[model samples]
Target: MLKSALVFRNAFKILKTKYLPYTKELQKVGGALDDEDWDKIASFLPFRQIFYDSTLSFFGSRYVTGNTFVEEIYDIGYRINRSIDDLNDGVKSMARQMKMKFDKY
Candidate 1:
């Protein structure tokens, strides 16, 4: 979970600083990204091509390569962070329950 959070943070940072500004122009391409644009996106992702292909497959044919790719990244990051927060909250709740049980004993 920590590793995922770290990776998410890094990826989101890169997306915000780098690719996000180009969102309009990139989307204008209609998923016909050139090599340079592709390289820019792939450079920050772990497992580069595999990650891209898997995301495309999971999210549908062109989610990763489509005009909304940048937006997708943002959404993915938001989901990941939300999941992490939920898990953390669950853990904290469990810990509190355990403490209450021990205190009663």
Candidate 2:
């Protein structure tokens, strides 16, 4: 949730600094730019391309991989939860070890 928020905030910043300026310049030219022209302008902004690619990959994977994409996301979530569980277990194990060592002394 926090990560998504940061991504949106950064995307907005890029839009403000890069894309908005280009758009204002286009408006000043006194005519509407068509889809193709807008695409051309967007292509020149490297950050826009990167942002679009990342966002598309996240939401478009389903279109490319069908149902497997959903399974993949579930697997990733499970692994993350497992990793947190393992870390917690490790801390308990270490505390047990310390307790045993002190008891022996």
Cα lDDT listed for each candidate = 0.47, 0.47
Alpha carbon deviation, residue 84, candidate 2 (Å): 0.6
| Winning candidate number (TM-score) | 1
Q: How well does candidate 2 match the true structure in TM-score terms?
A: 0.23
Models, CA RMSD each: 17.6, 18.3
lDDT, candidate 2, 7-74, per-residue tens: 36545445646676765765677634454444434433432333355456677755656465465545
- Model 2: ten consecutive residues of lowest lDDT: 42-51
Kindly state the number of residue pairs that clash in model 1: 0
What's the lDDT for residue 103 in model 1? Answer: 44
Candidate 1 lDDT score relative to the true structure: 0.47
How far is 26's C-alpha from truth in model 1 (Å)?
50
TM-score of 1: 0.24
